[model samples]
Target chain A: MDINTVNSLSYEDFVQVFGNVVEKCPLISAAVWSRRPFTGLSDIEANIAEFIDSLPRSGQEGILRCHPDLAGKDLQSGTLTRESNEEQSQAGMTALDSVEISRMRHLNSEYKKRFGFPFVICARMNDKEAILRQLSERLTNERETELERAIDEVKKICRLRLYNLVLSDTQNKL
Target chain B: MDINTVNSLSYEDFVQVFGNVVEKCPLISAAVWSRRPFTGLSDIEANIAEFIDSLPRSGQEGILRCHPDLAGKDLQSGTLTRESNEEQSQAGMTALDSVEISRMRHLNSEYKKRFGFPFVICARMNDKEAILRQLSERLTNERETELERAIDEVKKICRLRLYNLVLSDTQNKL
Candidate 1:
């Protein structure tokens, strides 16, 4: 979307457009959308600033909601857009050797059994080996601590997404 | 504990010590812990590496367990260990600004009413304002997505806690 068009979009329309990007990642979309009224926000920085300023208290939780479970490969690819999925695969898991993949699967099961949820991590910028190493290490964390750590990772993911959104918007303008 | 002490500790002991830190911030702790047996690793790089590695998974449902809806400000303060209190505080309502605090209370009520759990986030490393911003933005997400996000956030928190433990150990060694 063009800067002018994005800036001029009605709140609902804006939601519809950007919301699609965020649909699979609803928390991210809501985070971006909740902070709205992008008028005079031609540049990405201004848009982010406005978006941040416009965020509602209730929406933070929504932003936090969209993260996927760590080592869970079953989620619909739509949950992450093509771009994000590609980035994630490239950065975090594409190079996983069979041994690491098996370890990840075993850890994933154990983690889920203990915590009742899949392990979750923000996989945007990390490489495969680093993620595999993490999977092995975090297995020892008690349920109480591991759960909270996952959420913090989600926050980082949101921030990274926001940055990516702005960067993409800038690229689109160019 | 010192590196020698940490080295001497069994995996269970390591989990006990590092697990406490993971409870505070899982992503950070997990990231750090994954790189353990730190004989050759430098301190700062080890910490940074852990932080990088502790990100949440790409796409999966997350855990969601909130602290008690409302407790006396000091109820857990002296009773629990300092670190435990801090971990609770990361989820507790005290640190939020008035608006966010109230909204959290309100939404917490609604969420509890709906899902039988208090609104939870892995709040290590975030300030009241940023947290508030996220809270407001996330309210718009669907219930399922929000639940997933909450769990993801929790995992990230655990990883951070893991990272901290490693750093603390390295410091003790030095």
Candidate 2:
């Protein structure tokens, strides 16, 4: 779909098409539905990012909490969305040895205890080893930076998901 | 990071840890290197329905042909490495409008013209709108009595240099 096609969509249809890009946060897309007539994908993206940034710290935490933990039980239980399932697998979480899964589970529990939300990252954008390394290092950071960083990661994930949702052809040439 | 210490890896080192999942693809991780281990997440997934009920074909075509289209260019550019990239992104491809890419060009040209490989149907496992509707239709296929039906889709794609890969974790559950 092109800019005009989007421009022509009803609010409900638009939300239905893009609601899950933020991972169960359909309200974001719902809120964004009225701000149509987007100049292009970037304008639309910037608006969504700004909307997320405008949220209070608690609201941002809510967004962060919405994501499932890497290698968490939600993954094996089939609770994740197609986007989430695919992203986790791309990061190579699909075939962990029983031993690796247990280690990740431990780290996930520890991180949530300290951070108040799941550790957020764009898994489609990285590999398993890289994801693990960051998981370890972020544990020592001060709360403020980690919180800001997770939001930033969420934005990136949104961008990719949006691209997949409506703009792959026009995505600035590969 | 193992059960004892994914929590301990330096970001850079942890990245080196879970980078590769598919035994055959290494460049996927290498290409994703600068992207950072993603200060917050291990993910790795690939799909190639391993129904190898027979021996090797052209042997050379076996390797080059294993990959699916990466937005359809990796086949031409020779860049698909992460086995999961092809398959996870496969759903994203389903929505690309016919004008954005032709259906037959979309069908994958080189793969069929040269080699006799079949593009296997794991679409049954995916959730994209386009994937599901096509599933029950394919189920009508006489896979055993007409092994020929399976080969037909394969021959159609070879003309495009052929196509695509990925696995899902909770996919086993669904």
Best by lDDT: 2
Compared with the true structure, what per-residue lDDT tens digits does model 1 show for residues A14-99?
Answer: 53454433223322233343233444323333433343233332122223223344434533344555545655666755566678
Model 1, range B46-126, lDDT digits (tens) per residue? 553334233222112111221323322333255544554665576554555566556656765555455433455665656
Please report, as a residue range, the 10-residue window in candidate 2 chain A with the lowest summed lDDT. A165-174
Output the lDDT of residue A40, model 1.
35
Accuracy of chain B in candidate 2 (TM-score): 0.26
| Predicted candidate 2 versus true structure: per-residue lDDT over A49-135, tens digit per residue | 876776545556656766778888678898888999999998898988888888788888789778767788899888887888898
lDDT of 2 by residue, B1-174 (tens): 222243344322323443233122222222233233333222212111121112122221222234344345553464554433455355554355556345425343433332233233333245444543443344444434223444333332221111211112222211
Chain A TM-score, cand. 1: 0.62
Off by over 4 Å in 2: A168-174, B1-174
As for model 1, its CA RMSD to the true structure in angstroms is 16.5
Q: Each prediction's TM-score against the native?
A: 0.38, 0.49
